[model samples]
Target: MTDAVLKIENLQTYYGKSHILHGVSMEVAEGEIVTLLGRNGAGKTTTLRSLSGLTPPREGRIEIFGNDTTRWPAYRIARLGVGYVPEGRRIFPNLTVLENLAVPMTRPGPWTVDKVLELFPNLGTRRDSWGRQLSGGEQEMLAIARALLVNPKLLLLDEPSQGLAPLLVREVFRVVASMREQGISILLVEQNARFGLEVADRVYVLNDGQMIHSGPARELAKDEERVRALAGVGGKEDGVLTAKPKTSAA
Candidate 1:
């Protein structure tokens, strides 16, 4: 991997009085896809929040594009070319799809509303549809498209495959994989360990708010015993990793 596009060291975050992440540390290299995997409540989402400055870490160092942005405000971080698509697809419920796309005051880059619409033709066809009218998969697509309009060099995605059908999961992963070719680095938090491993160049496994494993995704994918110990055993139905997360801040 090239020099890191995003890096963190000793990241500690909290939710009011509850400490969620304990010295979590990781990185996403330039143009590489890195997946952060763990069972529910493993502080995966909190990690993304810390990186995006949504929930700034209580203690840590965060470097994006070589600038130390650990305590920068969220808007300042976004302007530095970091796009974050949070856990829920938080589009404006009453707005039209086209209206939603027009919301971001993006940095100058190759991604435009028309360009993203061309990438997601289904959305293009439903340009005038209200956000609440779209299906779950469509909403997910819209969220990702809107993130792209920020012209991000690094994208932080949280649980993108959640609540979608199997086919849609595959399609979403396909699009995510293509982003690397377009010179975008990704830090992906996914519960679908199967698809997460499939697309990632490298992997980071979180357990109890700490990083337990970090290595090439292929190495982790081929070792089922290690995967079981680190991320829990895989389900027989869809091969998803299922572990009982500790009762802590998720």
Candidate 2:
């Protein structure tokens, strides 16, 4: 238990024709809520894909739960107790809530069907409901519950709040915070900077597939300009994005 839950060094990834990620290094401590903050097309999702072995890094080191699984296949990495909830809540449209969770059942962690239902009571009420019948928030809860059922040591959630309503967004973060209290290491990639920082212990800012800044998440909230620049906030409405570098993170 003396190792970081998830660690990456100089992680680089490619998407076919061009290289995406540069030298990116970061770590998530056990039971800590860490976040990767960036805008659209900023390589945030690509980073998660790389870590999960979905988009294997061309050059880098990825260690999950103290094991060097860089060269391992996706199934191999997944079986090692790492759960990934992708950006879209990819639920089985025809399956019920319980059925969806049962799809990836590994079981060993502190999570159980009853406990997960308790965590999100609405799920219990909708157990027999089809995935397509639930609201966006309900679908998100189902995704988290399904991941928990796998008994993951580390959870990688990509844009959990994307396209959710304001209230549902708050609910999502609250759930994340509660998960941290229960000792889950979370790597969250979020476009909503305020929501991400609110629940994260540490935050990393990635630009053009390279990490530019990382520190206590609170420090990020204090610097409006820095947040605006690296995080894709405060950009004009021309849709022609320009890089506006600011002071580096200390």
C-alpha lDDT values of all predictions: 0.87, 0.82
Error of 1 at 195 (Å): 0.4
TM-score of 1: 0.93
- Per-residue lDDT tens digits for candidate 1, residues 1-250, read 3498898999999999999999998988898999998877789999999989899999989999999999999989999998888887897889999999998878999999999999999999999999999998899999999999999999999988877777888888889999999999999988777778889999999999999999999998887667767876342423532212332234
Q: List TM-score per model, in order.
A: 0.93, 0.89
Global lDDT for candidate 1? Answer: 0.87
The total number of steric clashes, by the backbone 3 Å criterion, in model 2 comes to 0
Give the top-scoring candidate (lDDT).
Answer: 1
